[model samples]
Target: MINRISAVFLFLFFTLNASFAQQVLTFKGELAPIGDRVEILTDSNSTMSLRSALSSKEFKRSSGSQFPNLGTTPYSYWIRFTLKNESNSKAMGIQLTQSMMDYVDFYQVQGDSVTRTNFTGHRRPFNNRFVKHQTYIYQVPIIKGESQTIYLKVKSGKQLTLPIYVGSIEEVVENAMIIDLLFGIYLGIIMVMLLYNLFIYFSIRDITYLYYVSYLGIVMLTQASMQGYIFRFILPAYPEIADMFIYISTSLIGIAAIEFSKHFLSSKQYTPLLHRISYIFWALYGIQISLAIAGFHNFSYTMMLALAMVSAVYVLYMAVVIMLKGFRPAKFFLIAWTGFIFCVIIYVLKDFDLIFHYNNITNFTLLIGSAFEAIMLSFALADKINILKVEKEQSQLETLKALQENERIIKEQNVVLEARVIERTSELHEANEELNSTLENLKQTQSQLVESEKMASLGQLTAGIAHEINNPINFVTSNINPLKRDIDILLAALDEIEIVGLSDSTISAKQLRIKEYKEELDFDYLKVEINQLVKGINEGASRTAEIVKGLRVFSRLDEDDLKKADINQCLDSTMIIANNQLNNNIKVIMEYGELPLVECYAGKLNQVFLNIIINGIHAIHTKFGSTSGGELKIATYADEENVFINIYDNGIGMGPETQKKIFEPFFTTKDVGEGTGLGMSIAYNTIKKHKGQISVMSSPGEGSQFSLQIPIHNNQSLSHLN
Candidate 1:
């Protein structure tokens, strides 16, 4: 009785455990997600054999709706299930969707005996499999109403994901063909984007396109490595190399994505701190590459996927940050990466089992996302071309606008110039008419001038004779009466002495009378006075002779060349000629300094001096009105290079407004008709023609000082110098 009870209890316990261990799948000629009726068994050491897994009961059932996503587990994961084929299919197709798993061992069991076994994986040589395909696939024979027990031993250095598909072989191939078609389209898109960007890159020579193109190529290689295309086609003999490329390509794709975005978004310029941090990540990616190459593939793959997730987040973060900072291109970059990042997140979450998962979602997630991202980024590059086009048009428009503005301003100035010319012409016409009328009147009075050139007589002869001879003539007249009076007194004294001498008187008496008469007449004083009178007459005549000499000296004014002359002498001659204008009320102060002879037109310079002195005399007259307190101070000073003359007058000085226009033609402080206003203008021109300058300083209540300077030996272009 005790043996019976123990057997029953053990049997009951085994039944419950077997029923609870896994669910059975009834195949109906359609794809079945392997997770629906699968038991997942794990071994930490990856040393669990098929016999051990079948004997041990340490297994876990999977949720039916999703694949068993065991993220990054390496080696020794076992999945076992039972299948009942109800449809008319001879074979059940088992597809392990992930291609990079190092080994996959499939077993078909018949009532505790191993009927058949197939061994294949990405790490094994390509021909070792019963069926040569990208993913690990197995064909197990089944019949209607008969059940098949299956086992799959999976091992990888990357993520340990068992995304299995159970269906008829025909259905499996159809699904694979569908996948190939999709991959072809994706590859076509990537190649098209590459070519399109390449065209733009050559057209504009933008480095951003190069970075993005290289990124697309690496992304294509990464997907190819992950899908076993590289191992199948490129390096069939090198399974180990094909296995390593997945991690290397994973790490490189991350690095490449970062580099591409860094340039494409202008991250360094817009986000300086983040740009620096990106260099730190570059170093981390270096470590990742080292890990992948050094055969630490499990850690490397885990780190790579984690880093890829983080990298996607980081780049997306940078894009969002720079977009808010008003980077225009970043907005479009954000849109592209947002989609890519979304798919990457889903793909990663599926591996990590963070979200509710499915088998087909994993493969489709990144495909759709990456394709969409690549296409949109291509459109973004196209938009950049459009932006450049718009900017060019804007620049052209701005240039045209500036030209129009300049033309408008020039037109206005031309209009103003035309108006001014018309007004000036009218004024000239009126002045010419007045001049002609005056000429006619002068012609009517021509006989009175006796045909002596009127302008020449007035401008030259009158100016010359009046400025040259008046002083000598005045000297003669001033001394004539005094000389006459002195002579008469001396003659009277001589007569008295002669009478004294002729008288018949004794010698002592005559001597006494002569001495007495000399005392009485003051004859000694008379002698002195006679000598002084003769000296005065001589000086007057000498001055007249000097006047004649100066006329000869000044006659060269008609010559066309310059002459060397003394500036002080020029001033003195002007004063002498202007003597009649001077009265006792006006005191002339000479402050002459030692001066060098200057090369100049003496006649013209003389005229300048006359004009200035005459103006000063008038200024003094205006101030004192024939009184004796007015002063005309003339000063001359020199250096080795040039001579300087200053004429100052304590007169009714001009205001600022008058001084500004003082040298202008037809400008004068004098009442109209009393002055022609041409004197100072002509004087200024003469000074300028000598390569010289003239300036004035004055205030209304103070005084006026006019300074003139000229070089000592300048004989250059006198006309243009003005």
Candidate 2:
């Protein structure tokens, strides 16, 4: 009975163990090619594991196409498969277990679709459905096996049948978060920079800033969309736009570079021609954009490449211009453009797949170039501001200096004007004093001239009266001489008659007595006495008449009347009138030549001659006094143009200093009371009135010569004489 009980317990235990094993069975397999079938059969298994012949001793069971008999809840399994390229080209496919596929989906990342596929508990027909999100479970049969790569994406949620099966899930999540965060930061930085530059452009109205902002915006959009961020969220409907963004970003970058170069380096200073070329590139870029919008992306891309090349050439030209111009920004621009060029080359190489890495280096280089460009552009802007400030200050300083100089000049002019005013005032005062003195002297000279004229007129009248009295006295004297003679004869006859008186013896005796008385009475002595008296009276009368003539000539009565007169005759008359004063003290020499009868005021000219002769006589008298004698020479001659009278004196000659002032009014060497000082002055005035000039030549102790030059009458009659 105890043996039977132990057998029952062993059966129950075996049954229970089988149920547990069936409930938790696991399978392992390998995806291998055997003839025409791809099988997953395990090489070894236990009661708790699924039955499979997929693994071998030579190859470990890395993955399988199917896993049957795997339990539900609390059981976990993973599968791996190696797909090979059965054709010459690469094959792309996916492998997953049916249970895991129920909650998972398949997505083709290489095409322009965002479709999803689900894998469920059962295998579905592989119909190559293009629109459906279906898992591709089929393998690509290999002609000559070449390894390919794909992912078996497993979706794990709360309803997942096994513990989450994933490789480095945390790492993937962290990497995705890092990429998102980095992209966000990059976008934020780009947005901030773009907005900041836009604000700057608005504030400054600089087109360069606008270009820079646009370039950065395009760069951010290209990077964001290129990484599928924009496709994932923002505009999933237009996946092709990302490609256009790439080209646009590139073109914008080139344009920005050109504009920045122009702004920073002052393109006008050097590469004006190249700047025009850059503008052409910009126009080409516009054409490229047009083409791109027209859906000619390839042509647009080609044109963009050409534009980029042109931009590079322009950059190089600008670099050369900057180097020649010696701008400091050239170095920075050159380095930045070169870096951009390298970046573009790398991007091109990356597109060709000749390079294994993405164009991260290109991006890095572009960033570096942008940084340099920004720094140089900022420096250039600052330099421009500083230069403008300096110019403004310099202009102001120059203006101030000019004002100061003008003020200084005005001040100097004012000082000079003041000095001139003072000088002019002083001269005016001196002129006024001289005028007053001259006025006083003129008054005194006028008084003296009037007195002299009065005295001369009185002398003329006195001489005329004396001449009339002399005529009467001479007549009386002549008559008295004859009467006395007759009286003497009568008295002698009476005496003879008395003596013969008393007789008729008479007449004969009386006549004889008268004759005797006439003989004896010294009638000759009586006659001599009477004649002496008469001769004396006659001499006195003749002297008086001569003085009257001199007075008349000196007075120049009727001098205004114009008449034809002989110059020699006038001179002779003057000499005759002056003879008395010049008789014994001075000798007169007349060298008279033949002259015309000039039309002139004869009386005035005669007066002029009289004055000059008298002056000559006085000069000689003053020279020799009464003790010595001097000669006064007078000459008259006529030339073709003039009738000249020369009055020369061998007397005390005047010095040059005295001769120069000799004709000046009131200027005389004579004592104050001795001369009226008008003789030469009157002569000079009279000669001037007659349109004649009187010139004097004199030297101290050598006498003086006066030449009176007068115009000769053309119609005058000349008498030729030696």
User: Which tens-of-lDDT digit does each residue in 1-722 have in candidate 2?
Assistant: 32443333232223222222111111112222211112122222221221111111222232331222222222223322333344333322233212212223232211121123333321222223222222124322223344321222232211121111111223323434554675576666667667777887788786767666766666666555444455445543443554455556667777776776676667876777776767777777888887767766545655665566567766767886786777765665566566556655554433333352232244244344444444444444445546657888999999999999999999989989999999999999999999999999997877678458436634533554554456646665776767677567757667766767766766887677667776886767767776776766667667666656655655557554556777887786666555556646677788999998777677666666766676677678878888656988888888887898889998788887998998886677877665666767767776777777999998888788888987765344322100
> What ranges in model 1 sit over 4 Å off?
1-24, 63-65, 403-722
Which number leads on TM-score? Answer: 1
How far residue 143's Cα lies from its native spot in candidate 2, in Å, is 71
Task: Give the CA lDDT, 0 to 100, for residue 216 in model 2.
Answer: 66
- TM-scores of the candidates in the order shown: 0.53, 0.34
Candidate 2 ranges with C-alpha deviation above 4 Å: 1-510, 524-543, 553-560, 714-722
For candidate 1, the C-alpha RMSD (Å) to the true structure equals 15.7
